[model samples]
Target chain A: MDPSEVDVPPLKDLTIDNITDNVKLINSQCPDPRLKYLLERLVQHVHDFARETRLSHNEWLAAIQFLTAVGQICTDVRQEFILLSDILGLSLLVDSIDHPKPADSTEGTVLGPFHTHDAHSEPNGTQIAHDPDGEPCLVLCTIKDRSGKPVSDVKIDIWETDSKGKYDVQYEGREQPDQRAVMHSDEEGKFWFKAIVPVPYPIPHDGPVGKLLKLLKRHCYRPSHMHFMFEKEGFDHLITALYLRGDPYETSDAVFGVKESLLIDLGTVNAEQAKTYGVKEGTKTIVYDFVLVSEEDSRKLREAKAMAAMKHLGLRMKLYNGLPVPEID
Target chain B: MDPSEVDVPPLKDLTIDNITDNVKLINSQCPDPRLKYLLERLVQHVHDFARETRLSHNEWLAAIQFLTAVGQICTDVRQEFILLSDILGLSLLVDSIDHPKPADSTEGTVLGPFHTHDAHSEPNGTQIAHDPDGEPCLVLCTIKDRSGKPVSDVKIDIWETDSKGKYDVQYEGREQPDQRAVMHSDEEGKFWFKAIVPVPYPIPHDGPVGKLLKLLKRHCYRPSHMHFMFEKEGFDHLITALYLRGDPYETSDAVFGVKESLLIDLGTVNAEQAKTYGVKEGTKTIVYDFVLVSEEDSRKLREAKAMAAMKHLGLRMKLYNGLPVPEID
Candidate 1:
């Protein structure tokens, strides 16, 4: 507190004139041996990015607001951020990194924003086409091995909407289970079902994700398709989607779900041929089978293993995505 | 764009599953090879911090909104986020990193959130005491080198307010200049001023930063003090703030601007000493002169730099206490 002590200047002076100094300053906040190196790097890139863009203050504010709205739109039954990721191609990128296909194998496309995992398994020859208004068409298909030989006893779980493009869970006035089904293929590696070829339609668009799409001048429609899971022993079990042909939205499918290998021919059957399947003449039928790669050896974030490892790791668990998950310690 | 070529998957995939992954992903984006390593490291630490906290969606959303508001409040006239950095002790950390103070030297504190580049420079023998009710004071001190040699031609830039604890810009109706001084010390390396002892006061609140302080359960008062800048060649130029002795906010000052070396002694200068400075006899007065070290090179954001670079780097050109400007390429 002495006045005399103030007159003598000390060493270590800093001259700040530009943005690069920020990079250096952030570099100095190193603490924990593990994080020191990381902080130093991020500060540099963040500063560099900001400098390179000359990003205005208002633009930065808008970005923050957009992220805030993205968070506000997330809910128990809806994942608009995930939908955003799907539309922006980030989700597809992640799935792509984890799933690589060999030549002549099933090509994985974008999985639309909605997915349910508790589908009940049905035995072979079960009819899942509950919608009477749908085109009564008999679908015939065979599950084959990579070498093209038929593989019997393959499980084929299928689900699709009715001709009006309304899934069962979506429309309440429709008959119970009218637009959805779960069925398995026969032991002879064949599956037949009676359903209509679904038409492409727009996703629900009253939300922020929808608003963002409109802002980006993009559409909200996805090509109509059916979902399937086909699996057998010693072959890759595939969970895939098969799209119907002659849909105009196929080329510009908003969810980016259209893939060439998944498109099925929806040709009409004659009255004589349709009579064999107990349907009227010129009755158009729709059918498709899914192909999946065996993921038996893929890395899975299983709860059992995670719990066992949590003790020594000092891990803390939180509820996320409706699961008790251990975050990184 | 052809309808027939619709089913296509993207070429590459990326996911930020962990801090290490984030480091790797962000590092690859840095254009400058020199900065790549640093940015990679920073992203790792920031991501690790997020991971370590297991920050919730709501909390992250709050943080994003806070930052957005901070940015939004920042106009060309006022940058609230920078002020936030100053008040939160981050500005000091940045100063520490950029300056690299030697151990046992004076501890550097933050350049408090309000400094105007256009602070009117005062000449020797000019009185800035505009408030008639203030405690009259005479400040006198000599600038010296580390070896105690008196430094000549030392430039002293000083600024403070009247005893009522209000700055000119803060009081809209007063119509008086709370900031009124542009003076340097004499050839004896001595500087002196006569004014009322400034009183401690709360910083201007009512802004969003003030609201955030309330949310964090912190206060907004700053202990009374005067700002000083002293400089000469080859010595460390300093921008030091001195706190008033026995001020109420001393120990628990909100912004953590208290430094032992920066505290001034309130020794009573009798009537005889007061007469020498042209102040009324026995009138209360306080005095302290600050010394500064020589500055090295200063850095600035490159003008016409890439748009992205300007975003983050532009924050540096903001508050120049005292330093040489660096090249902008």
Candidate 2:
């Protein structure tokens, strides 16, 4: 815009001591209060981080280049930034903040970068393992609400890695989904599917995020788990994973995605139970119940949690002439 | 490496309340103590920002996509990240932190993204205006140290915008540089050059950074200024600019680079003075001195300033068992 068209306050001589305030003041004209608030808080925290760390010029440049590399490496299927966020535990943190559920409801976790929408819908008890690379496992699951009412017709997108510790998308020239499918729960809120036992595998570490992990002396592996994304009318969209017991990386999942409530045990199905599940005797099996919360309840819980956090942080709920400076002890 | 080969402390089921600590714990194994400290501080500040603002899932996704676009748009000639830093006031902040000058020394500012290494070396007093697009201006300057000692042979790379508020680099299919050149201070520490009067110009606004500025209700124009970068043996590399007083955007420079000390008035050179500067009569003139600090002095000052900031922020000087958590009041 032409300089004359800009509405600016009398700007103070920007110094280290006042630059943050100056930026906030200039940006106060944003029409969206929420955006203005977010920008203000963002500037405050980032500036504080720089000041507190006494970030050197070289270090700052390195960070810029690092982020650039992270961004440049992203492709249609690979999202290095999400991987970076996952390794830093931000993805899970955001999920937890957005999806706080009741004690009985299933907990949420990181939705890693491999999920795809092209999985073909299949019948219950149909085997999703097209590669035949891992031991067959029967997954028997029930979906219900907190009040123990069956929630039928919940569309569940299930995916997992093969015994080779890789998803179908990770392989070159992959044309169709393997060990992944879309299924629906019956009127009884029950669903059964056959899949290969997933194995622990390292996240894609050949890019900048991988280099960072190496520098931090960290492994990039995530624990073996089955990804489940549920979509149903009147229910909160659920993105979660069920981690298997005794996986090598179970306790040290690189993405910090493991939660005690989300961990389930793997068992061998007896002859009678195998017949009922429509699987062979002695097949590996997983049995777990997914307790979902209603969309209204989820939204209310999130708002309450957000308010409590704001209070804990001493933030105001309403806008004022200027935002109160967050105290830095 | 195998999971068993990876060294880990006892694992705890990660919860929102404990995730930050767990991430730090896992990353504490980093061999480099400084990197470890920086990472810890970065995680703390970012996580705090997310929590305090109750950053929504949509907001987080938006941020990720914005950053990715910023990175993807960078090229050999364009540094969108540095531009991002400039608009955010981080570029100037880093300059201030790294180059803390004394009262008598020339203050430093942003080394904006338009600088190039291909500037042709030109004789003193040579006119660099290849295009007859703007009014002529003569720049007369001397290089000196803090003690008023003349510092000779200082290589100065000078650049500025045309009256149209655009740099040569901004033009499509540009060839040789114009309105920019590399000159050197003589034995008397004096140098003069004839160039066009730079006009206030908007930073590139067709990209994501531009979109952000528009969102913040900010004008992307930086006040009229001439960029100067100096390099000399035994002296600090100085990157600074001289802003014209009374420019409409002087106080609201998009990059926050307008320091009080860096503002200079434009005057008309009389016939006699124009002859000395080898410019036509009534040419606009800018008279300013460049004061530089020695390499040793600059390093000492930066180190002391960093030490003090660390102390003020409650950071430790030496490595400890673990970094002290920064207080967030």
Candidate 3:
């Protein structure tokens, strides 16, 4: 060592030692081989990060406050943070990385937080209930393959909110479960149902998540829509919601559930066809076709079909029916 | 958009008969052009994965519950979830990518959450009052450069719990800070302090974070030790803690802070050296040296560094005369 450079440690040196040593001791307790390596690495980064930023106590406290607010806003019915997750694209990102779909399919979208699996399955074209009302419309739809062939005898689980923006399960007071049903297609993969065009509604604002939105200066409204789940032998099962086009919430639909492909044209039909279809014919009618994508397992489909039969079991499936492949000729 | 496939209606085909016919509606409210494509690819995968695993509602709920529990376990003093992050190897994985510490520098590790920004900065060789009664030991240490040259006149911040594992700040009804002090190094890059060997201690157990560990059936303790944060210009500032090799809690620290490299021997010393220093020379002494790595800036070391520092502000920073680079060459 050069005598000209007499060793001189500064006050900062002492400050550094006060922290580095404890960090070393705490990290040493890790036993999980993987965890130990991870702890050591994390501790170093955390400590270094702290020192670099010259972090202060009050700033740390503010962070704690932000997190506490985030917690206060969460509830069983409203998960603003989860919606935040959707916006950040993390939920869908994780979902995609884990479940890549085939190229030719009716592309799946988000399963908004409002869905409950316990919907009552009804017979083909059976109406679930009547509560509130909107523009009465007829659903004239067919199920088909990519090749345009009819997929016979498919199942469609359907549910929607009443015109007042309330679901059958979300409200409780005067009446029965309104605006909900499950339907099965006939031999030609065709079915028609009676319903009213949905009305857009705001999310439940009676919770902490709602309060948080107010604090953040954001909105909590969703576009009017109906939910559907479709499955059949040898084809992919899909979950999606159909949105009303004219609704102002069509763009900033709060839950981010809109897609161009799912919007159907509910053109005014003459009163004649509405009556023939049980509704007054020529009344407003929306017509669209559902397309199913092929999958790897047909036996799973048969099992799903069977599970649909055993509704008393709370919708339990004895086995999973995978997508059925085409019989390539 | 193929002509032979499902017909792609021309702009003319889309009319204003109803708002649904407006082509601009598809692009505006759903303003993000890429959103549909992304969600389409993601949701299909998520649903298929759920089907493949036959994932049940109960299992899914449990998974979400576990994540919530992890978040609930974090606090200023205890960060079990951070340990979980460490053990999961995510922290180190991030550290590896972000701060590739300059080779030949202090090996970095994870920074557990209980760091304080400002500590008492005392003169070189100041005695830190650990407790009124305990064995006397002299900490003789020198901070040196990479070329074995000493850093003259640098300060070392020192803090350690009493023999019973209690820092002055942690004791109930305590009047003044105990055992912890900010001290400067002499011109010879050397420092000496009087204290008893610190004994192992348990972490605090009276908070929600603690209640969680009890429910999980895990123990809560940390090995006895001292904290040190070493810094100098033309070098990276390091935050580290040394682990007492033989402490009872060595293997079971709840915060997971421990490392073989940071452990010290605290071997027995004779009366002559003790007398030479100050005491009757019969006092026990534990001597150790701190090693720091070189770097450009400590703040930008990692993203988390900025986060931890900004967490608090009023924490103190003790300025020195000036930071002169130690002559390593």
The worst-scoring run of ten residues by lDDT in candidate 1 chain A lies at A2-11
Expressed as tens digits, the lDDT of each residue in A1-329 for candidate 2 is 55567798766368778899988898888777778878888888888877776676788989999999999998767888888899898888888887887898999888988888889999998999866669999888999999999899999999988888888888889888888899999999999998987788999989999889888888888889999999998898899999988888888888888888888889888989876877789888888899999999998788777767777777657422222223331
TM-score sort, best first: 2, 3, 1
**Taking the tens digit of each residue's C-alpha lDDT, what string does model 2 give over B1-329?**
44565587545467678888889888887777778878888888888877777776778889989999999988767788999998888888888887778778999999998998999999898988766869888889999999999899999999987778888888889888988999999998998888888788889888889999998889998889999999998998899999999988888888999988889999899989966766678788899998999988987787777767778766667422222233331
lDDT for each residue of candidate 3 in B27-132, tens digit (9 for 90 to 100): 2222232222222322333333333333333334443454444445554444545444433333333333334344444444444444444566777556776566
Best by DockQ: 2
Alpha carbon lDDT of residue B177, candidate 1? 48
Q: Which regions of candidate 1 deviate over 4 angstroms?
A: A1-329, B1-13, B16-26, B29-34, B102-107, B162-164, B172-177, B289-291, B296-329
Measured with C-alpha atoms, the lDDT of residue A195 in candidate 2 is 90
Pairs that clash in candidate 2: A327-B329
The most accurate candidate by TM-score is 2
CA RMSD, predictions in order: 13.6, 3.6, 14.9
Off by over 4 Å in 2: A1-5, A273-278, A318-329, B1-5, B318-329
TM-score of 1: 0.49
What's the candidate order when arranged by decreasing lDDT?
2, 1, 3
Whichever of 1 and 3 has more lDDT, that candidate is 1
Task: Give the DockQ (2 decimals) of all models.
Answer: 0.05, 0.54, 0.06
